[model samples]
Target: MTVHPDRLDELVRAARAGGVRGVGRRSFLRGASVSALAVGVPGLLAACGTESQVQTAESCTSEDRSAAEKALVFSNWPEYIDRKGKKMPTLEEFQTTSGISVTYNTDINDNTEFFGKVKDQLGGCEPIGRDIITMTDWMAARMVALGWVQELDMGAMPHVEANLKSDLRSPTWDPDRSYSVPWQSGLTGIAYNAKYTGEVGSFEELMTRSDLKGKVSLLSEMGDTMLFMLLLEGADPEDFTEEQWSGALGRLEGYVGSGQIRRFTGNDYIRDLNAGNVVACEAWSGDVIAMQYDNPDIKWVVPEEGLSLWSDNMLVPNKAEHKANAEALMDFYYQPEIAAQLAAWVNYICPVEGAQEAMEQVDPSLVDNPLIFPDEDFLANAYGFMELDESTRQQYDKDFARVIGA
Candidate 1:
């Protein structure tokens, strides 16, 4: 379903007037309030599920439902989910067992644009016109702070509560997970074409080596690239302050200004790296996996300095029309067997604990891949990006635009 531009703006205006200070606070309150209202409205709950069922984290009984009945409206990135000629069994099972239908859509291509579209409405009491959305951890944190998401019902998601990675829980963004649930986790590291880079061993080798100057690319996004730079500079991302960020930005500006740097990129880095047009660039761990499928020579490395551990989470929007169904779907995905299928297909880090073993049952070869199941040693070198305050985010964005624009 498309979010009308005008309507989204109207909602944003309403939310702005409702004393919502930021995107997170606004979206959370708006989603919760709207869901609460919809639950109270006669016939609304009945239309979605049994009137007396009272859907909560603890109440989603997966029985006597059809695949089509558990229809969920999910918004995600393009090509992110598994499909076989239009069939999604994992989602289909939710429909069959819980009697909930899922209308999955992939309309979110950019995070900033998506936030801008719904910021207003979520600030108010209206549903943000979406049941669920998947976005990066940093953006999720922003939405959580604005109150644009619903606190997950852990009781309903026992599988998730039990299986989710320890590090992913109690994040600084949503200390108690009052707003979001991690859909997948991955690392930000160096992806290089071995043929072009000639035995590149570290991040510094790509950035500082004279031979590789003008051949390397870095992520244009502030969070992904800057955090990597901070780690290289020996700054602790988890404990960094505004002063440290300023220092990181300054160093990044120098790299950008010099002719030593190539272009900044996003997913295009994958294409460029695969084609040997770019030797090394900052890349998501999952994208690297996809690239490797085509070019075995491509190498993804977590620098000796360390790398960023990132998670993109699923959230129920404030203006969601089907919160109960949405919550049920969330809980359903948390199941180990179900989550394994998604992780195997998507090739991201599974949040569910036993998902790796479940995936091994499906395909034994996948169990040993570090990218899919990061080991303790590798994880020891990973750090989640720290949350930036509004002012810092604004400044960082400005600097990022300058680098990309130049």
Candidate 2:
């Protein structure tokens, strides 16, 4: 949580190279040949949180099949793993050492879409055929609240118990992360192609500036985009009343009506931004970092209002076919050496406590990178959006859809 001033200064100097290039659709694992373009994520990720779909009280029981079964399945976003050719080095090693073959699937791009696919199965306590699934914070919270995931046997996960970052320990949804573990954390902020526009310092400026009008795109995700609007309206996102939320939504409607905002986006903004068709947009920190590598003219901004913070978490779906095997994979990833390797590749804030020290050995330059290892002062300027319940989540999604014309 503390970074030395000298180290901070040096990192700042290095960061002038236009900050770190971020990861694409974090947790994304693809065919390795795909040159990870800029960040692009579906709004379905942000759309998760509504409990109106289906509800269930049945809990999935875990049985130790590890004695006979040596296989597990993991589904995550694309382009997230560390690799060498077609083989994932870490996963390969995990397989060799633990004798657990992994069926890794990068099919999870949208949290809501994935949930819809399995909700029927999970609601009935039927095996979803997957052992582990990575989800955004809000979606994971919804699953845990519905008892759709198994409570992790922490006794079998000493590495995780010892290595989880302190700040992430007590989220409002999962006080102890009993049913989830943070996979990676990211910031939602402003990203602009500087070659076409000057510094777009604040969300208010981006929303109203003439040149940026029709060229600006806000994120489709409700929490990430609406929270910034709430801040601009002088409301605290972490704890806001229904009235405050209404005011924020009203502001968004005005921009859309005025044609100042082009459209709502997930990952498609990356293509438009690269082609210079879009001048500025609401962007994720990891995506901006990744884009900067390809074009230094690309810039990420932490608006005066503050950045929205979020985490993608890992969970064991209820009635998973291989719970113990999934836990083994979870424990293996908690190893600082492995966590650092993944963090170095993905370019998000690592959630494992000791990964920073391990980062020194993997890539010394990233040791002081603020994006990878933000200290207290930097984190102070970031805030998470208001947590939502069933009725509120449904209403907010409805409101957001009307504004975005989705």
Candidate 3:
């Protein structure tokens, strides 16, 4: 049964607050019975009560070959995966050997919208009908807290355990990766047109320089933009609080009122920077690489105050149908050779530790590119945004929407 859009948002907000698994026990049983009647699948309904009901990777052994044989339905953002001429060898090989059909879909257009669409089904006892999905770090953390995501069985993903970067291994959101795996990472920092603004040494310079009064832009994303602002304000990103958030918002609103911002943007900042309409703007590290490839004059800077180091993570929705196949796909991408090819195409920071060395063997130049492999010193100045509680998130969304919409 489909969920109403408005109710879905409420459920997500509730899930974020209550934790995905903390729904009242009686309510869970009721939802399961209702779902059984709606789907008319009694056997599936029988498996919907306690933690035992959820399928762990180990449970999908030779005994459950039939269920595991079904195709894995994977979903992610557009252009996030590797593909060449309609062929994905990494995926194709999994299909060839594992005898599991793969339906890779890019249906996630925005985080809040995706959360709204699937939150209800995931909150219920039965399967959410998706084996795997990718989402940004904060959203992934929310899903994990709600217990709407399954704890990955690392034993089934040996490649991931061996090859994933140690730094990415123990994120504050999901320490030890109990719920998610980083798909790729990058920094959110300043990107400026060299022709318009000689050289940007700091974020403050980019925002307040007299010459760039109305030509500066910042990201429209609440978490991304706020984290950068907090860093510039000298707040510790790892332990930011509501008071700090309020201060950052006040500073941002001041800049907005003063005509210091050209506009808050997403990918549009890329085009504007290229056209020289914007002298400086907030930019993703990977996007800067793309822009520089086209025009050498555009430069990305990890601000002196620091930058937000972010990642998009892969997670298994609670009670996914094809759990084994999904685990296999996760392992497939972690293989260094496969990961190298993906990094080459996407140009994001590879979370696979050895993927860069593997890529250098394939194409030597990628080894020294700072954007591809941010140096230790550069990483020293980067920080991950702390996860906010439900109340804080609402406050952030309200403040952010007003700033952007105004």
Candidate 4:
């Protein structure tokens, strides 16, 4: 639940020196190693079941015991919160102020893998024992569609209602954000080693520039990679038709066939880019930020095509006994001060709006770090991928997998 402060400082130093790197939040979505890439799509498909497991409040009733129990259980990704040894200073403050006993677990590695672990119970409208579970947009969308999560009392989480970034407030699947709240967000864009190449400008250049041929890499995740391809083909990624998807896929296939692409990658692209083996590639914001500390030549660019904006969200599953308590925790973190502390440590985009100003006190160095605290204009070019049904998603993932040599 917490990291030692000294350990945290050491991590910052090590990351700057390129001697250590924490896993990018979605790195596990593809594979831990390139050799294991083939299994990634299949794993995701297994989580996106064919049949709808939809439920209603009447069908799966839940009780709120926060009035008496004063306890909450939360599961999140590793090192996601600000910490000092076994104590989370911000969370400890919440427990003290609200009288809510908290149990936090960092057990989420891969979204689909975590889904597999809880699907049977969630499908049956049973409690998954977690009051709060953090998930990426697609997985959250799937769970919300399945009716496996509970609607939040938005009025009760006033901080979240007030501070959540406008860009993240309206995901297609939960347009009104009735069931999910973002924990953190980041961008997917162009990253290049300045030592090896001139500034790479856009997705179009990454795909067609002869100078970058056989030296560039793309992310292996379908949504992150294909979104850019869709943009290149003049298709809106948020509302593309099947024909548009095929066109994008065809363009990607052409690039691959021409040997213009080095390989599709997970976080392993960091290794190749650092060694100059990969001159330019599609990259995550957080990884590029860490790499820059060691290699100032490692540059991140908001592509001419646009950026892919995504988040890890928090949701309360159906039948969770501590719904109110979980809501309280969500609200607590949404407070700008607490949000800034978390952002200072995790270095992801803080989803709480006023956190940038609050960072003036928490860590002034990060106050202007665009990767961690981007303004609205900087985020204007960002887009989210279209939501899809299970069958369509499965087919698309399979198509992407085959082309990427997964």
Candidate with best lDDT = 4
Candidate 4 lDDT tens digits, 51-99: 7567888888988888989999999976678778778999899999999
lDDT of 1 by residue, 120-223 (tens): 66655455557889989888877766556666667767767787778778888888886788888888888788887676667777678888788888876677
- Cα-based RMSD of the predictions, in order? 15.2, 21.9, 14.1, 17.3
Q: If both were scored by TM-score, which would come out higher, candidate 1 or candidate 4? A: 1
TM-score of 3: 0.76
Q: Spell out the clash pairs found in candidate 4.
A: 3-85, 4-85
lDDT of each: 0.75, 0.84, 0.78, 0.88
Name the runs in model 1 displaced over 4 angstroms: 1-70, 124-126
Candidate 1 displacement at residue 209 in angstroms:
2.7
Clashes of 1: 44
What local lDDT does model 4 show for residue 139?
A: 86
lDDT (Cα, 0-100) at 237 in candidate 2: 94
Report the error of model 1 at residue 167, Å.
2.7
Model 4 Cα displacement at 63 (Å)?
4.1
How would you encode candidate 3's per-residue C-alpha lDDT over 1-406 as one tens digit per residue? 9999999998889787775767677889999989878888766665895442223334422122326366788898765666777987677877887788989888876677788888766655446567889988988877776667777779989999998888788877788897788888888888889987788868788778889988988887777888877877779877877788779888888888888898887556778898889989888887777667679999988787887888999898866766677788888889888888877766788888788778877667887776668888878878887778666776778888887665
Best TM-score among the predictions, by candidate number: 2
TM-scores for all candidates: the values are 0.77, 0.83, 0.76, 0.76
